[model samples]
Target chain A: MAPPPLAALHSLGFPAKRLADLATMAGLSLWQPQAGNAGGRVKPTALRVLVLLGHAWEDQVANTWTEPYTAWIEVAALADHSILELIQRARDTSLYISFTTITANRRDLAGEVLSMIGGRRRLSRDSRDNIELALHEALSNAVLHGNLQLESLSGLSVDALERFSNNLTCRITDPDFANRRIDVICDIIGDAVTIDVVDQGNGFLPKPRPEPQASGRGFDLISVSCQSFRLLDGGRRLSMRFPA
Target chain B: MDYAIDIKEQEALVRLTGRLTFNDHAKLRALIKEMLQNAAKRQILDLANLEFVDSAGIGMLLIAREELSNLDKQFILRKAGGQVKRVLTVAQLGKLITIEE
Candidate 1:
């Protein structure tokens, strides 16, 4: 089957850069499929891009969202087939975002996800703030602890912060650690939004903080913002629900 | 995040603007250290224009409080509104530091 034309993608609300990125990332030749046939036919996964785009386009026309094409493209870059499947099942009711362990990328993804969620629904100010804070904690945990394997809440001293920052910089530059992916799946239904963040790392049990410290308060914040949360996949995954 | 320091008598007023989170750890540490060195009695964090505070930001604020306490100096957070105020309240930081409305 032929991939959708660039015009179709544009009409579907995808910007030129986003469409180009999608084509490159998915290894799809939207304009010249035969020119790239030396590498064989388009990968099946590439076709799913169309399905995903189509879903967003339909949602846009239905007035569910005005502009979701770029966001979908961003998700498509890192999302595995499972995420795509999940999104297909509930495109109008959910959002799925994933990215590598790069700190900036994680922040951008989180920011984009939060913006979309906020724009799509009319959430209370409290609910929006809580979700924003909680999701920040979750993303930080995924990058710093899960993928980078950094120590938590090292120390309150200036020296400690310096050492932590140095170590973090070194870890971020190492491909073995930085290439790992963190996935955020958010399901919004009724007055509740459930967000699940999954990382590719050996997870650890979240221990109770016995004292008020400079670090390790992430769990406390998450607990405060989320209605309920649970660890899954040996702690590699954290799922939290926020109610309106 | 951006911060401005104003030394008024023995008190140093550090006006913080924008989001404070893990990303601003280095800057926050430097700011706190500088405030401690200059402020004779108290270091007041003016968060009137601060829009966001994450858990890490809360943690950093606690760090500032702890360090100031060891110096026998006051670390006061004032004018925090909206999200910053809410996070400070949820983290129960008022028990550890002086939070002035």
Candidate 2:
């Protein structure tokens, strides 16, 4: 089948130069519904793949376009290589979202990603719960240990917990840590959907905690929840596969 | 996550609603403090309305349990259903804390 037609949309304040670069990289035609039509207007439903440059475009597309589209990409996440992969995978529904550590901390990213994918594919209740749990753990690891470089809570003591909380507050407020990028890439192939949570930080390997403790169950939960998973990029990237 | 606590003479029942994750650390800390100060000997967390929980949320629950145990108060998890219940089971939380149906 021919590749679905792709269009790029941006919100106010998004750089036109970057949009043009993205359009060139992905061979996407620009669609500015908000801008008065100099050329004939194309109906939103006609576009099969939308590359959204800002959060506002997401809301606008959701509200204005009633028909289901093949896939959508958040432009913030467009690395040169990932952009190429996204074009290749656009034939299958996929999503790429990248956000700063502060944004990830503030938003329910796992839930939002799940809801977005749920719109494209039907997920069983059990599968949905499992994916949500695994994705939540993966994102937490990315934002906390991966991006912000916060250590796992040392112990269950109130004092230890207090110190951890203080450090979390400190790191999240620091722009150096707060502005680190976290990328989530999702691709659907056949009956399985693979989601990768990638972070820019010093990578980490999970340590075994033989004793019952307050922390360190993130990996355990992820292992049990997903069909299979792997830690790549020196543990900076976690890829999880789930049944759709 | 948000909670409503009812401190009775024998037990303090805290109903936790909404999703619990690492983001709720501050709120969880405050809840732990409240549970520690309550006069009741048993602290129960009602998880029926808790729609979801992550591993970090599980750790926070462990913190609550440990803090209460240190104070010679019993910590119990009650009415965990759906995702919460499944997570509690997968984490083997029942072995560490008392869980009531």
Candidate 3:
């Protein structure tokens, strides 16, 4: 008998409505499993492809189904691409995500990306933690320091923090700063995974601090967490690599 | 992040849960105010349930420690496990704050 024309599109942690819309746009009939069905369990016999978006459903999908081609893609990466193209790219390429500074500030971009990647590949606990930390620093720098052009927290005082907060609020509320784009591109080849975080900023020059302070340890943490990293495009782009 | 604080005669123990990132600035600010106004001389932050933290979170913690120290008060972090523990070690935060395992 011919395989069922239905496709199983699991939202994982991604929004169900978005996934459903994507499925509709792709001209595919979707078979959504009942909500709160333990593990999002679905029989794969009638499915052509399994498209799992987001990372929240990783363990469930892993333990539930093994057959059928699965495309693990981040929902944010869905923009500007046809669903068919995305599924093909999910198999051939990796992930490319672009969002405005406002979205980056509002979402846990690093965590979502890490979870998507982790679902597709097996990352050791330590490696996952390191990647998550390094990515968090990279995204934070791209949003706050690069795109928003905000100064570092100068001192360890409530007043200083308040000033910083005020500055952040002011900048984020401004369209010129908030609307700048930040792009994250990920690629996996052999045993290495490379992620590049690019921002639309004027670029930065790293300076060495002479004293131990409360802030400015972002680069330090990123340096130790990833295997290797490079600041390109005049510091507007941070490229980091990790062991797959 | 969310926190529940227990105030005693000499110390205030705060149990912090959820992810403590830069986004928690407002809450952290409120937490700092509570720590400063309370009569307790020692502020203990329990991180046993805090699942994750970032560089900004670390900076906020430093801010708390510094503000408390200005008034001769002590700040301590205890029971940080998993990812939080690893981040603290990597950031070399132990040299600056008292972390109780």
Candidate 4:
């Protein structure tokens, strides 16, 4: 038989005692970087786990383990079971889910939603691909643009994108910005799915893309993939409907 | 994403594996710089092992194409399959880069 969950975490090199303490803390934990370990390294396995959990950032290659780590692991812990329930709820019955999460980017949440919906629905390859791509754009926009309140790339050039990415890394670590919440709601009816990603930051109107450009493609991708999409709450809420 | 580049004659072949998203920006930039320094007449990115790509990845590819075009060096994509191919197609990158079968 497989080892118990806690045992598995221990075998994976997690601090079992710390994990237990955090569990008791009920999804809240304070992390402070250990003294004399400023440049410490994270194990490869732990780094992979953090990436899969969406807790690692793009610019964290060298500093993967350099900073203090704090997380409410309840969401990460539910990967296995939540994945199954997500699909079952969509297939066997109507499914409605609303999740509110801190501003830290949670790409896994979007990945989970897509995987579950794909498993339950018999969508054509094109349709499935479109939905996955569109959903990713939506989630990215919600986190980077909405909650983080960062402007999209000013130009398609490499320099511009690099600057945007660097700014993102710094902004996500700020409590004033990182503490904001992104609300995701998914409603599945029969074979169709509608998802709304709402953010608390000030919203903006999407300008028309008169030509091919680097930024602002999020709206275009969503429009092409879904049957219809509307910007509501002055762009704070993006609701997209994918047809069966 | 992770990449390995092989140089043969005037052409450079790069094999990319793993998800290519915003996370790979720095690595991708360094790789592009390396490709530019090689002074190869042509560069081909092979994506058969690539599993996923996001909008930022697409933009990076465009940047590569534009930079190469400025140097009059040929840049092409090869062997993209599965989701990677789908995303490339959706982004209409074929209008700017050569995709080889």
The numbered model that scores best in TM-score is 2
Report the TM-score measured on chain A for model 4. 0.58
What are the per-residue Cα lDDT tens digits for candidate 2 across A93-129? 4566656787777767787778767766789999889
Model 2: CA > 4 A from native: A1-6, A15-26, A33-93
Error of 4 at A70 (Å): 24
Best by DockQ: 2
Off by over 4 Å in 4: A1-106, A118-124
lDDT of each: 0.68, 0.77, 0.77, 0.63
Can you give the lDDT of residue A66 in candidate 1? 25
* lDDT string, candidate 4, A1-244, tens digits: 1111110111112355644453343332323234553333433123111111223223332232221111112222334455234323222222223333342374455665565465446778777777777778887887788878888677656687679879988887776777565655565565678877777778856798776666676676678789899999988888888975
Supply the DockQ value of model 4. Answer: 0.30
* Model 1 chain A: worst 10 consecutive residues (lDDT sum): A2-11
* TM-score of model number 2: 0.85
Q: Name model 1 segments beyond 4 Å from true.
A: A1-66, A70-93, A103-108
TM-score per candidate, in order? Answer: 0.76, 0.85, 0.76, 0.69
